[model samples]
Target: MKKTTFILPILVIAVVAALSAVFIVDEREKALVLRFGRVVAVQEQPGLAFKVPLIDEVVTYDDRILSLEVGPLEVTPEDDRRLVVDAFARYRITDLRQFREAVGASGIPGAENRLDKIMRAQTREVLGSVSSNDILSSDRAALMLRIRNGAISEASGFGIEVIDVRLKRTDLPQANLDATFARMRAEREREAADEIARGEEAAQRVRAQADRTEVELVSEAEREAEVIRGEADAERNAIFAEAYGRDPEFFEFYRSLTAYARSMQDGNSSMVLSPDSEFFNYLKSSTGGVSTR
Candidate 1:
């Protein structure tokens, strides 16, 4: 019983010692074993690891790529246009030892801060070389490529690998936005005025053409009417000439009777005339002979 009691304490001590030396790491993590607070070895696999009890330490770091949103930065392009640019970056610890040596285990935030500064500087450098129109147009992709490449180049010494850099948004300043809108409105108004002027010119031309057509139509109708009246008068004269040629004496007598009827219609007429006057003779003539009636 005494041996068992002594062995129990030894077992407890051994278990405690074992617990102190044991290190557990996940698949997506890497651990650095430190002796006297100095890095001695790096363990990268998922399993149990060993360390000196009470004298060694283990510091674990995430091995996967981390996302860092660097937030928004105000920038001005070459055209003197100001905008706010929001961006994000994906990075990973390529060299764990260097990462631990350069930035302590609790220094990821500092490294991120440094990376943010570098990215902002590079973004400003690249973007400052382009105009606002280019940034908003077909050169956006090229600008982003240049910025990413520049950031990768600058981040090489910081023990971090820049996997990707992306621009989230680019916003124009409020004052500039109002100016742009006003310019657009003025352009639109000018275009509209030009169109209206063109339309009025077209309408005037159409009206002139219509007036010319109306004048031509009226002149043609007047000429045709005059021709028709002249033809009718000529036809009447020809018929009268034909009738006069058929009977000369009868026509003369009929014209004398028509003149007498018109002159005698006023019953109060008094005329100085001789009995043998031709005008009285025609009136006195009756039947087929000339006689006083």
Candidate 2:
């Protein structure tokens, strides 16, 4: 019973020691085993790992790609125009030992700080040489490439791999915004005025054309009507001549009747003519007679 009790206690102690000495490394993590504050082993694969129970410690770091947002950095370009530029970067730690050495106790934060500084410095260096207009231009793609290359080169020293770098936005300074907006408003007003003037000019042309067309149409119709009236009058005169040749007395009577009808056509007509007036001759003698006067 004494032996069994002693062995049971030993087994319990062994189990406790084993539990303390064993650690796990996830697939998403990389671990470092340190002995007396000195790194002794690196475990990069997933599964169970062993370490000295009391004298060793493990530190795990994310072995995946990380993201960083560098800045809304104020930059002055070649044109001496100030702009607010923001940027983002993707980075990964390629060398764990160097990363640990470079950052020490601060870990990811320290590394991020380094990346931000390098990225910002490169951004300034590349963008500062270009005009503000260039930054806003289509050549921005090339400019970003230059900045990214610079950052990648500079960050390599800290065992960091720059996967990509990009400028998020570049904006004018607040002080410049008001002036720009005012200028834009003025330009738009000028363009609108030009458009209005052109429209008015076109409208005038259309009105002039319509007036000319109306005058031409009325003049043509009047000319055609005058021609028709002249032909009808000639025909009527010929008919009267034929009637006169056929019967002189009847023609005289018809002419007298027509003259009398003209003199009395108005509903309220009044005449103060002498009876000898030629106008009254036809009325005075319906049978037709030449006026003696």
Candidate 3:
């Protein structure tokens, strides 16, 4: 019984020791084994891991890609125009040993602080070298790539891999907003005025053309009427000549009668002439002094 008690205690102690030495590393996590604050081993893969229970410490960090947001940082561009910029980054811990050494006990939080600095510096350096227009334009993708490249080089020293960097937003500073809006409004108003002026000029041109067409049409109609009137007068004169040629004496008598009728049409009209005037011939002689055939 004594021997069995001793063996039971030894087995229990061994089991306790084994349980304390073993740990699990999840697929989403990376672990570092530190002995007396010195990194002894790195477990990047998911599986079982072992460590000295009392003397060694295990620190775990997320293995997945991490995200960091930089500031609404103010930067001045080459044009001396200031802009407010917000940016974000994707990164991961590529070397666990170096990361632990670099960050020490601060872990991910410390690494992030340093990473943020690196990103901010690169952002200002790359974006500041270009004009604000370029930073705000679609060409900003190229600038972002430059920032990412710069950050990657700097971050590599601490075992952090910068996957990507992007500008979330770029805007004119609050102080510049009113000025910019005023300038935009002025430009729009100028354009509107130009459009209205052009429309007026075009309307004037159309109206002038219409007026000229009206004058031409009226002038042409008047000329045509005059031509018709002249033709009609010529035709009447020709008819009178033909009648006179047929009978000269009768035509004279008819002309005298026409003149007498016209002169006596108004009761108030009076004309003083010699009694032997030719106008009175029709009144003096019924056949105009020509004997009937």
Candidate 4:
């Protein structure tokens, strides 16, 4: 009776322990319980979980964020610019049953491989329609959104939810880089030449305007000087006419005296005169009142 009691208690305790075994799932983890190599329950909550012991196997998967970097791919844009683009993505396993069925034994590597293929194909298809400048500039965000949407949609079968997609780097081949740089340099030089030519043209226009102004000013000054000179000459002639009209006889005598003085200024000069010449009549009148010595 004592042996039966001990054995029965031991069996009851074992059965209770086996039927009442509980699992503590973390907030960031999902638990998969398999019975006899077949998944029987999926626990996604952050509490205790009961399962049949010895027959149930538990698999814990992280429900946190996961990152996968796709390998570099060569893409040609609409402008014929070839680039090696490296990209990455963030995702999480949203469906454990589907993940287990699709991933099988390969785990995350299998998921990453499948993602890489899809990413490469979608990247090529999306970027191929855009020019290189657009890809490098404003269209990048739209392109990434499209890639994320397409990846999530396609990866739905694999039980993966894509959160975001980002491009890490875009590289140009060495030969293409050299060509692009050369073209850029040529364009800059052409623009510089055009600016220089425009500046020279503007300078020429300014100089021409200045020269025209200078010519106009000089012509105006010359005209003004000629008018003043004419006015001065007319004024002098009017004064002379007024004086001469007032005393014609005295003016004639003064003019004759001025002529005689200018003519006698040369020392070796001879004069011919009549005895009753007007020049001698003045001298005779002065001598009659004074006496010749």
- Tens digits of lDDT, candidate 3, 1-293: 99998999999999999998999999999999989999999999899999998888899999999999998898999999999999999999999998888888898889999999998999999988999889989767899999999999999998999999989999999879889999999999999999999999999999999999999999999999999999999999999999899888888878877777788896847899999987777678765576588
Q: Which 10 residues in a row give candidate 4 its minimum summed lDDT? A: 284-293
Model 2 gets an lDDT of 0.87
Estimate every model's Cα lDDT from 0 to 1. Answer: 0.84, 0.87, 0.91, 0.85
lDDT of 2 at 84: 89
Best model per lDDT:
3
In model 3, which regions exceed 4 Å deviation?
1-13, 137-142, 174-182, 241-293
Quote each prediction's TM-score: 0.74, 0.74, 0.73, 0.62
Judged by whole-model lDDT over C-alpha atoms, candidate 4 comes out at 0.85
TM-score, structure 2 vs. true: 0.74
Candidate 1 local lDDT, 85-150, one digit each (tens): 898999887777877777775668878988899899988998899887877774477787888888
Residue pairs clashing, model 3: none
List model 4 lDDT by residue over 1-293, tens digit each: 99998999899989788666877899989988988767899999988998887678888888998998888889999988899899999999999899888987687788889988988988998889988887777448999999899898999898999999998888887788899899999999999999999999999999999999999999999999999999999998897788779766555656666776787796847888798987654457653333233
Question: On a 0 to 1 TM-score scale, where does candidate 4 land against the true structure?
Answer: 0.62
Candidate closer to the true structure by lDDT (higher is better), 1 or 4:
4
User: Sort by TM-score, best first: what order?
Assistant: 2, 1, 3, 4
How far in Å is the alpha carbon of 32 misplaced in model 1? 2.1
Each candidate's clash count: 0, 0, 0, 0
Per-residue lDDT of candidate 2, residues 1-293 (tens digit): 99998999999999989999999999999998888767889898899999999889999988898899976899999999989899999888887777777787788898899899998899899999999998987658888889878988888887789988888889987778888899999999999999999999999999999999999999999999999999999999899889889878777767777776787787847879777877666567764464333
Model 4 clash pairs are: none
